[model samples]
Target chain A: MAEIELPAGIMPDYRQQLPKFLKDYAGRWIGHAEVRPGVLKHWADDGQTCYTVRILLPPNGLLSAATVRRLAGWIRKYALTGRRTCRQSFELVGVAPDKIEELIAEVKASGLVVGGTGATWHQIKCCTSFVHCQNAAIDAPSIAKVLSDMLLALEEQKFPAPLKISVGGCPNQCGGGTDADIGITGVFRDPPQVDEEKLLAANEDIGLLISWCPTAAIRPKPLPEGMAVEINPARCVRCSSCAQVAPGGVSMGRERGAALSVGGQGGNSRGGPQMGAVIFPFLPAEPPDYALLKERVHSIIAYWLHEARPGEKIGSLAKRLGWGRFLAGVGVEDIESLIDDYYPARTVRRNLHFKF
Target chain B: MKAEWQELPLCRQLMQGLYPSHVAELSQTRYPLQMYEEGLKKGVSAYDYGGYISIPEIPSGAGVRTSRRPDILPESPYLRVLGPAGGWLSADTLERLADCAEKYGNGLIHLANGGTIELYAAREKLVPLVRELNSFGLDVGSTGDDLRCLTSCCGPARCDLALVDAPALATYLGQRFIDDQQYPGFPQKCKSAVAGCPNDCIRAMMQKDHSFIGVFRDLPVINNEEFKSWLAEGGDPERLVNGCPEKALKWDGHELFLDGDTCVRCMFCINNCPAIRPGRERGVAWVVGGKYGHRGPQGPMVGYVLVPFIPLTGEEGFVYLGDIFAAFLELWSEHGRRKERIGDFVARFGPRRILRALGLKAEPQILLWPKNNAFANKQGRRGGEGNGGN
Candidate 1:
């Protein structure tokens, strides 16, 4: 056996190595304003201004080695940089005021858009999809790409409020889809199919599988030679918990689609942080061009643009007008899935004290 | 050592429109593309969701598990390196990371939505990779049922609207909870985040189990000169007036006034008009029980405002915040069930109980709807009060 030389695990202090302007104005930043749509100017108390130029990355946030090297080279050539954003966008900090245009043009030449500032449509973010994660019900990246391409122009325009969108490969929502203004989550309709042979072969713990099911959908079924688990389809919410616990034993069915949700906002500006309510519970996960999905998104955006007050986010607007009115405004039919069935007593009003 | 490669048609089709296609990126690495191609052929995923190596002989091996431990690490086990707070990486660091990825298991790197850098590697190579990463100020963890990395918005370092140093706070917390980040002792994964201000660009409130949001306790100060200059520079007064959610701002042509009591400290004014700056008295609000996972009885939920205001004087403020975090983790670990997330645990015990346990008072900020008891039942059980019971 060879001895492994382990180095001391200490993360470097990024503040020490920050770009010149940022290091100089680390704590002296007083105020900031959007110089333009994608460009920003941060003012220090000493009257020094630091400029930042934001650019959109690919929806899935996947960068090849070559592209990463190229970005690193640009960072060195332009202004030295700092932190990138949480969203699917990259920020180059400490850009000179005189060189802002040149940097934007150079970035554009590399085939990336400079936008996602102010009140405009932000870059769409999606999960790893089936590319890496096995739990993905739909190819989320493809869907996100199609939507992002169509909505690229909106990134440059000033909207009523900042809008963000996310796509989750599954309801697990690794991409925080439900936290976005418009959330698209993949969902499976039916319960998992139990393979008794595989379950026995794999020596899976039937108890673990049964316990993993949130709705108690799995039950121990004794066979002549071995024991297996059975899924109660009626009780299953299709959360993929059982399948995750016992992969080869409990598997999800093929009836899969996407769920469209709206009115979600992460900020505490108006209605505070709230998850998007599922509007269209099930939409087909069509590939290449998701016409039906695009149509619904367009309609929702149109209604929001026409009806919302200036600087009002979708969630706050929904809160003011009521989800029902917003639904009707978008011409969506009220369905059973649209209602919060978790607690019937809470959601359903007993009296006729309703708005007509 | 040479890496094997395969051209996957189905993966290529799925990644057609994507820039720097993931498939193309993986194809240049040691990642097994045949699994993807075979899975695509079978209309399912090549990697097992249950973290088992895919069995080739079984028909629809979706249910065919292997002799691998189901606890952690998949077939092509990947290491999730905790990214710098707010995704801050130097150009040199980026080049090193890229080199590391190519030199080790695979050439491709995934900027995970959870604010981590994921790189695929074989089980045997994990040790050497971690050692290498450690040499360059990087470490791998955030796997299994442990404390995940604390992600924060780029605060005062980048954004001017920041009320507190969000990245600094996150880094402080991360350092304090380093042991938790490395060990998998918790009942379930605990995620945390810090937002610079009310404009939570990181979506911390709805995505993390515990979130600290930078907030101002006082009224927004108006710079009269800046205001006039902004107006002179074609700033829309109508839009600013109309955009106020609380109607707290009023302009009588000669002067612009703000109703202090009406303002909720939402930061809308500060964000829209540069003249309006956040009040000096700033601190972080502790919000707990937020999660995006649709698991357990209480599905997805936004966190409750546990503490409306925790005055942050300096580095000592981090100690106060850390105290609350440690207390909550202890409470959850003691009472929570196996595989139960903090959000579900909080839901079962009720926010009132949680506040009481933490020795905190319930403020009006904690209430989503004031004086609304529609969700309460005759038994006095609050909404979201039961465990696996509707």
Candidate 2:
């Protein structure tokens, strides 16, 4: 192939343009290490061999500008290009094997992990929780950091299969947690608090508030000054619609925590893929360690590790073993509270076992 | 035993050269074969063989046919291909896919109902065809039970009603969960989607097992100038004023004012009028348990508003959402019964229990039906509430 000449007065030097520390690490490979095969081999359009280096980002998918700049530097130094993988990792293509080690070392020096592939815990993914989100009830990154620390050691351990754990700061699981090996989401227990004064000031459109509520949780009460809306705490899901519709008139309550679900595997298997189900209704968000929450998760994983057959995903194993046995194996004491069959049995009568 | 339509010429024609030969032979021995033959002869498409073909007694991976069309001697079986999130494909990619379709399969490409692409190819050609497609950076999957493509509406990219970047979020999710799209290892298929705002052009809440709907945390921002201009352009002021579900809009002949407290932000007004727009404070509402199929217990249900909102901003936003998705997938995979959709699972186990396990407070918004006492008067309160009576 003929090389195309660039017509430029001055091309930006991205590598030399980097800071001294980043420049020093250029062309060096910082190995984060992978238990499973991380190398990807593909042919270019010209049929030339191309090598791509994959590196796992730390849990929560946050990367500093310095790290990104160094990555860019590495890409520039190697004359390679980069793209992000679906698993929240970066893949730098067109690197030779001779420079792989150095490149990995350089990336490591930049404080980024290099492995999140194969039959171990992958990079922990999360949504913006309390940090930047106005609707988040718990600090999602804090929980993710703790979980990452707990599971990162296992990234190198060969398990029955690869596992993905996703966390949503709130129930609106932007992280795709519903279809992972494990999913965690924050929750709010109380209804939004109604600022009667604000409601009065905002024109107290009581009828609008009542009609907008998905669940008829808001009711208009005659106030001495003007109309005020009262939330039926029993019926409120705390979806924040009222607050959205009437901004200053309503606000989220103080009570907040997290929820845990398990066995959500997405692959073409026996019955296609399945959405994860909640194993625990609610676990108080105990920061730093999150002891009780971690224990339950650990117990579920332990049971699956011991009992699951080869090539069996957590969802498939749960099905094969029966939900009752699976719950028992996980050391769940109140199984009845967690599992109920009446509703499903009554509703889906035709093609009950129909596979997609 | 039945002679009503057996002797008819239409029935004879229908029986002649039926694609699946076994059904032809079974006609002689089966009891209801005559009824099926009658229906087929009466112009009911042979593909509409619904009740006659029984579902498998046990859920098995084998013999699963995605399309209703039978493969004849020269025709190839159908293969499903997944489209990019929001069904947005670049022209170059489309050209490649079109070339692959023409070369590998019958000269046709189908956009499936689940927001995926389909190509009809010989069974033998599937592997190689997929390989060819892989070269173009596209893959075939979303057939069996697994996470299908994550769909979204054109957010700020094209539509003015959008509150958040729907396509960006969808693409983010598509890239983040690409493996799940290719692999089918769950009890059943799972669908997910994102909508830029409450307009929900993509029907995320009803068709997807997991849905993220864009929402505003504050009241809709009304541009007085735009409102006045709209009024001048023959925008029916009386209709707009009386159209508010909560009667929140007031028109003083020349100007319009919004009663923020009374507005429900259902997007009706915004949808109706071009001048009014959603507020600046935007985020996503996580709704779960939605599915279109009726095979599950909760037959064709709309998702429950699981979380009122989760703000999408920066890298932390993506991380927080990813973590939550992973956790729920694990929980459902561990306990959900065979062929149980997340919606049915939520219905059976109850959203409260699901929320409890996830450490979410059980709020009234998750309830499928309003409580009987929702409108009932409190014991200590008189009828003066909201009445504005002295």
Candidate 3:
């Protein structure tokens, strides 16, 4: 729980902590309170504000007055439209002398707890969920707010390397979470199951309604006394097809749970679709209960975090290892159903998985 | 109408003026021997497809596809085959091709996709020798930036999971394009493809600027009409579900359902379940950007989802798809450059931006998400497949 203070300067790098020009503004009062302690806002000579935070937290989470004064100088001089709140340039300088490293380390490890800083993501933020948005399929922000501390806890140390993670309220992939390293997109696994006899009694066109499933998961079947219906678990990817059909369809039986796939990318910023790969078939865990997702992600990615050569993107590991070796090395007895491994049995029979 | 070649009388001697000989549907011995006997009957050798298509044959040589500079061809040579690829030399055919190279033209070989080997010879020299080479089981064809030999990954006999008749499709497309290789007023020598599946082991995605990947929609549905038949037919629902990596399928007793959302439209389920049946969604997602290593950003590429679902079974569908791609090029060629990859060109003048400029719908769905590994765990967008392995 060591705290580290960041040096201040706003050039390309913000690590210039003890600068020559701001050496004089170290111990002064900007408004009423002492610029050096407690809860006080200190404005640089240029009228740009900096926060001289006195932290009772970790090294990565604390800041000091000197750092604030130094940062304020640049913000006032160079920050474009600094008055706009979304675009504020306050520094966490004059940390309580007890927790600077802890503060900086947190920034390095958990992007959420540390907030946005140089080269790191702005924050592990989110929007309201089903309780909030009419269309939200899962509880997004609650999961975000709940897991926020733990997610940030890891940021207390330098990561194997920094990567972006985001979450969304629905399949729309909004908030740019689909492009992030760890994106939690909420979706319904068990769509509304239709009660055929009841629906027909209500004058619903079950035959035509069956055609609407994207995976063609619905089909009309004969029932005993009246015409009951059947649901296709094979073709249903829990995309609300049944719900859309029944409207109040089955309430999706709690939460049909989640499916985890990997390999999505916006290409290398250059170009390339980079479609994701399937790592887990389906995990029966409900949203707001992201403990499962977090734990699984930790295990599956542990090898990546622990074994990957420094600076190697997780994507490259799959390519270099070749899909077969990658699956076997990770003890994944089977992965054919993942990203369409159409490679025949003998084609890559070098491994035990292919006996032919 | 004779099927054999040795019966023709005389072919080469028929060239009274410019005609060299006849190579098509010969009547036993090539009529050339008789034509030659009737005096030096000589005319420039003609061909079947093009009027007097010349095959100015040259002496054999080893270096073909290896040479970068285009060697000047002899007058009247309509086509050429260019290179040393995967052991083009069978020992006998090697020397003859090389001798032609040394005596007739540049000592080079043209590497070809259809496995044709050649050196550039004078256009005039092509006509006469084309027939002679054909007699020796060799034929001359047009070789330029436009015409590429459409091919496959050998086939299941030598490969695996060659579900579709890949060789036949490739041959069809190749022969079809060969006739129109110069006909289509393409933005550039447009590329077309016929890959068997996603493995695309042939690297067809990277080679041709455009390609067709085979996909089959076989995820099971709880259609007792179908599922009962499948299960009654001894179909194990467990095996089917186990077969799908995406877990797009599951069996809850008598009910069989297709996890449609998880399915990528691959034909595995269909291949596995004969009773499950395949739907009209049986074709490829025509991707526009899959090139690799030209200016190298791993060759910035993305296989766009153009023509979402097509029936690879019908001629109307094939022709319709052809027109779809053709129509796209008709518009794209107006803005593209010689060096720009189709995707780059599309991005520069994005589908939306271009549509607006051209009064189109600005379709953004064409943006293809290429397969990448680096960011899969963090940004991967699949179910049960994200880094969180089930």
Candidate 4:
């Protein structure tokens, strides 16, 4: 093999010097990098070095063809490759160490933020609530954008630990909000409106519809026209299962809102992974401002910042301080309906009833 | 400590089966104290060892955790090999995997519950093992909070009950989202699966975050001749009629009649008798938010059907489903909190707003019908009261 010589303090122009196969192989390379104050570096398995350039994207995860083309050009120029990061950011690899500042500036010039690492807020994730999902009960992306903008400053401000906020349009939780430090999901306060005529026309079996309800909210009715499905308003959990099972027969109620959960984390660290608990179950879906929801989220974050120990996640912190004290610190007064201690145990011996 | 089976009631009961009068002699021979003493001499402690040895690490990707079994000798790391959809592995691939396991691991391959193959190897051999796996057009993943391998049930390839090509759809999805599987980027792990029919042998609707289940829009087609023959061959007509959940099936001596209006299409009748099969019109229903793990907010839950029916006809059908999936991924990735699962996300966010964002109209199919308030006027009043309560 010919010994290819490279200039000192500079990276070789691999796009020109390396064979197409090697370049293609490099393009398929996938990995992670540690970002310092203003520099990023990732190493390959063979001890190859590459500088990282981060490109933060919108919560909707849409990138224009033009933006992708421009990014490709930058990758070609640096004789590097790009991989999409888990936090919805694109990291350009194999950039020359000297070109870090240049690449950052170039990416910034194209109206993209270039920071999503360290103790700061990594990325906000939203589910396809009401966007393209037939099951969505709320507008997830819009709320996500709003929340992202609200917490934009935190993206650069280094926290004691990483902070993540997720939003889902409904309880399906495509956003995985249950495992985030701060999680938000949409909710419905009422049952679906049933059209008897449509229900009969669709040949929907009332028995199946009744069985589909998770909350036992559905029942069959003998109307003058025929058999129709009805919902028990008090019993309905608003899971939307009935509507999904019988499309034309049932529809979502008019009253829709958002719910807030806290202290969820996903990792193999202390306390393991945890799902978020509902701190506030009903925040009306008032858009553009969502003032109530924002205030509550901010309060939780503020309390976490004040109380959490360094390197401790929100879930762990919640466990350490006790959920009651944590709620008190966050100034959440309503606790009657709080469902923090209801995880179903694997083995419940119904027979063991001890008289206390 | 004493050899007295006569004194110990449990030992007497055990000896009653075989020893009878020789219970004392058998008890003397079984020296539990001596065995414990020997174990102690061999460095075996009565207490379980809880700590683990730190091993040298390699970065496969973000969120991938190398599992360690300290109890086993050599402390081999367990690597999950992403398999083809529906757990189908060709002989060549299996042979290569076996060879790799023999050369680099403990020569043991464990088929995991998550539909992936596990290879127990040394930590140092993982990267090279993965590299070799890549050469065979296979990779290792589904370890951490990323998209796990797309699983499926045997579809039209083998099962007559299959309404769609589940394996093919899974393969397509696996290929399309290979990056999502290889790269751990989500707040938490996202799992997906495809089932060919409502039978759902893979349990996709209960175990996966997102599941595409085969559904028949129309009624089940009953072959009268086949039904008659089945009936003549001891297939009880009364049993089949009663098996219908809605009591839609009626047998009048010679022939069977189905009341299509009352049929719920739960597949009970079809599953009971082979003579009846799913209708010609087939589609898939998208279900979301299912999870078996109880870590999150709502605890363990079965998925809710999101879309009642999405017609799967041709390339356009795949594209339509793909577009919906892509949209979901984008939304969840961009806005989801770190480590949040889709189910928990939906719980926090109301489904109404999600549907609005997706540009989907509010469909009646996604709502729960009230069982008690059957009368329209009563329901209207109750609904009004419920709104006021909110």
Give me the runs in candidate 4 sitting further than 4 Å from their true place. Answer: A1-33, A37-40, A44-47, A154-156, A340-356, B1-190, B193-390
Docking class of 1: acceptable
Task: List where candidate 2 sits over 4 angstroms from the true fold.
Answer: A1-37, A43-48, A202-208, A266-270, A339-356, B1-390
TM-score of candidate 4 to 2 decimals: 0.47
Model 3 Cα lDDT, one tens digit per residue, A1-356: 88775411110011112233323443222222223322234344355443433222111111122222322332333321111001111234433334434444543342212233322222332333331123345444334443443444453333443344444444433222334445555555555567555565655546545644545666667766555456777655554434534542222434534445444443221123354454564554443336786676555456566655543334555555665665554446655546432223422345465321
Please report the candidate that would top lDDT against the real structure.
1
Error of 4 at A67 (Å): 2.7
> Which 10-residue window of candidate 4 chain B scores lowest in summed lDDT?
B17-26
lDDT string, candidate 4, B132-196, tens digits: 76677666666566788777774443245667777668777776776676656787778898888
Instruction: Please say which candidate is ahead in lDDT: 1 or 3.
Output: 1
Worst 10 residues of 2 chain A by lDDT: A7-16
lDDT of 1 at B104: 82
Query: On a 0 to 100 scale, what is the lDDT of residue A247 in model 1?
Result: 72
Interface RMSD of the predictions, in order shown? Answer: 3.5, 25.4, 34.9, 26.2
Cα lDDT, model 2, residue B135: 64
TM-score of model 4 (first chain only)? 0.81
Best by TM-score: 1
The sequence of per-residue lDDT tens digits that candidate 3 reaches over residues B281-387 is 45555556544212211222444545444456543355555555556665566666443446655555444443344333423434445445565322212332111
Per-residue alpha-carbon lDDT of candidate 1 for residues A175-211, written as tens digits (9 for 90 to 100): 7678888999988987778888998997876787788
RMSD of every candidate to native, in Å, equals 5.6, 29.1, 34.9, 28.3
Which lDDT value does model 1 have at A135?
81
